[model samples]
Target: MTTGAPTPAYRTSTSQQPRRSRLRTLLPLGLAAWLVLEIWLLTVVAGAAGGFTVFLLLLAGFLLGAMVIKRAGRRAFKNLNEALQRGTAPGQGGGNGLMMLGGLLLMIPGLASDALGLLLLLPPVQKAVGAYAERRLRQATPGTLGDAFQQARIHRPDGKVVPGEVIRDEQ
Candidate 1:
């Protein structure tokens, strides 16, 4: 026979609502704000310069973004192929990923995004951003993702690793 307490007729304080994740709570709000800002900025531009000018700007940004994306993709694939041919691990990431990101940002409608995308395309900006990311990865706490990276770095032929997993067949 079960020996547990009977259920209470009234609700108890122990039963609480599940906490929402920070991303879940804020992402929609952030997207909404960004959309509003983009729309407002586009209207302002349209008022200052005719709608045709705005249309031209959007078309230009889209075309440039597509070109940049194509170039970056080709470069990245070439690098990978060369590394494979050499029978060695791939080289560390350079600006290709960031360039792709910039291209994607440029493709998004809005002058602000276009400006930010252009900035990302700059060599100096890419270097600074790369350095910052490197610093962050190095600074990550032990036993976390940082540890995995450290292990992977040690094993890679060029002492570099991208997204990967290690499996040891323990005997």
Candidate 2:
């Protein structure tokens, strides 16, 4: 005999739609808006300073983005090395990851994204974002940071914890 009442019927709530569906609906709209705004800004700048100036600005932006990407990439590698040497997980709080993201954003060809990338590269903003990410990750996981640090095995398909090790074979 069943021990409890029947389960309620499965019902879909309007607010419970999958995140991918929501993103699919919003992505096109956002892209169109960005294109329109970019075009408008381009026209205004061209009218004020001529087409050559606009071209120069775009070229300058591209150069700046390249430089930012190069610098951020180097810094991220440095941070990763330091973390490894200290026996800690790299990007424990997501700062290095965010820095890489910011650099990639800068690489993208758009004024708004470049501005956002520059902001994300700032030390204060990176710290804030890292803290927020760490908090969210902690809330989503079952164990404390210490437990995560101590974990050095992988759960296999049969539910056995296999010891994890990195092996490099040079031919």
Candidate 3:
């Protein structure tokens, strides 16, 4: 007797939908609002004495913060690599999708966005995340993926068994 499920199709398109990310949609609006508010605050603080000085200070702060991030980012990646080389699981993560997003957020031109990105890029924070991931990986059963793929690699023809890549004898 045959089961009722339909035969599965082999070929299918697996492309993801083209939708703007939620953060991408919201971040620009948030940055614009923050820029307006900061400008207003700077005007109020400077108040007829010297608004230009406040703007200059803001510019200086932005430059200093960017420099700090550049330096720290380099250090964090270097240490992360060292940890991996020493055979201890690195606290910091590389090739993580979220961390990449955080880096992109840092590349935004405004102080607020840059600050948020830098916070995300912090080594301690990344390390904590990496530790959690390592724990999960350690707890997983070994050979699960290997067994699944091994079963797939077996070949069966006409109800007779064949294993691995099938090679035919040349006539």
Question: In lDDT terms, which candidate is top?
Answer: 1
Error (Å) of candidate 1 at residue 171 is: 18
lDDT of 2 by residue, 37-90 (tens): 778888887899999987887777677777776776787788889999999887
Candidate 2 runs further than 4 Å off = 1-20, 86-88, 91-94, 138-171
User: What digit string (tens of lDDT, one per residue) describes model 3 on residues 49-74?
Assistant: 58677566556656655665566577
- Computed on alpha carbons, the lDDT of every model, listed in order, comes to 0.89, 0.77, 0.65
Arranged by lDDT, best first: 1, 2, 3
What CA RMSD would you report for each candidate? 8.3, 9.3, 11.5
Highest TM-score scorer: 1
Provide TM-scores for the models. 0.72, 0.61, 0.39
Candidate 2 at residue 84, lDDT? 94
Q: Can you write out model 1's per-residue Cα lDDT over 68-107, one digit (the tens) per residue?
A: 9999999999999999999998877789999998998899
